[model samples]
Target: MSNLPPLNNETIWDIINDKIDDAMVNQLVWDCLGYSYDNSSQQWDINNVASEWREEYPEPPNFIENRPPTVKLTRSIPPENKQLLKEELGFKGYKVGEFGPRQTRRATVANWLLSYMKQKRETSDR
Candidate 1:
């Protein structure tokens, strides 16, 4: 009875990433699967579409299984101290254990600082 297309992995992923809000994505998926969203369960009841899809396609491999763990930025450094640290890292040659040569270290640090500042400004505008 629904006008929605059949649900598939790619279709679900596209819906989720298509610049829509989470609620809309949930509704679309529910409608496509012919399942009403259940607030009590906080999920759509498994419909025949999902059951059939599961039979046809095994679950996706855990892509993030081997991914590096995310770094948590819980603590903030003072702006002046951060600037001083950047300057020190910029001027000093690479330490004995580091990967790159002295000149490369300065250039790399400078580039990183410039990129960091640019990203900060861009994100603040949002």
Candidate 2:
């Protein structure tokens, strides 16, 4: 039996969105992470380049499924933590797509769990 929970309903989504990272639901709380609803109505300022960049890049859909990353990581994950997610946590990569995107550091982490979940469910059915 795989450690990963099979994707059904919203289990996988929760894991990707809430389980792994602390997400800020509030928009008014001042912070340099995620979106701030309070700033949504700010007038466009030519001097403040940050205002422009805020709209351009957030958590890009660098992963598979063309799905936006539910976890908005602010920093690079340490190697030890990576090992935990990979070795103990049982994260796997995509079965489809280019090799670099599929196997390299940019490989989809959620896809790892999702693919394994699918495999586990398939074998269990038989």
Candidate 3:
């Protein structure tokens, strides 16, 4: 159990979104799901409460799926310059083409490159 005070569903969600470390939030999620942390699997064991909680509160939408494929970087950086930046950032081929789940820092750079590519296609159509 976490040292933090008991949090309702909304408060748990708020804490999850805030600056707290992800590992801590993961434990909180397990608490909410009524699961006990398992050291071996590095995961929680789903208990009876989890199934009932799911009936009450459906899972939140996946962040990457919910977000736009590209951030709005095009409004600031022109497509040509962005291409040079993308090359410098070293996101090529499949990495450049897909906006998949990745480490936060790398994902931010990838999103910027994707934004530029998106704008290039948009401008080319005109």
- The lDDT values for all models are 0.36, 0.35, 0.41
- The superposed Cα distance between candidate 2 and the true structure at residue 70, in angstroms, equals 13
Using all chains and alpha carbons, the TM-scores for the candidates as numbered come to 0.22, 0.28, 0.28
TM-score of 2: 0.28
6-30 in candidate 3: lDDT tens per residue? Answer: 4443333333234444344434434
Model 1 misplaced stretches (Cα beyond 4 Å): 1-100
Worst 10 residues of 1 by lDDT: 66-75
How well is each residue in 1-126 modelled by candidate 1, as lDDT tens digits? 244434333333333233333334434433433455467877544454455433432322111121111000101223443443246333343457653332332233233333344455678999
Per residue, candidate 2 scores C-alpha lDDT tens digits across 1-126 of 123343442444444343432221111111222233334655333232244335654322333332333233212233333343455445454345635422332233543444444555678999
**Best model per lDDT:** 3
lDDT of 2: 0.35
How displaced is residue 3 in candidate 1, in Å? Answer: 63
What are the per-model numbers of colliding residue pairs? 0, 1, 0
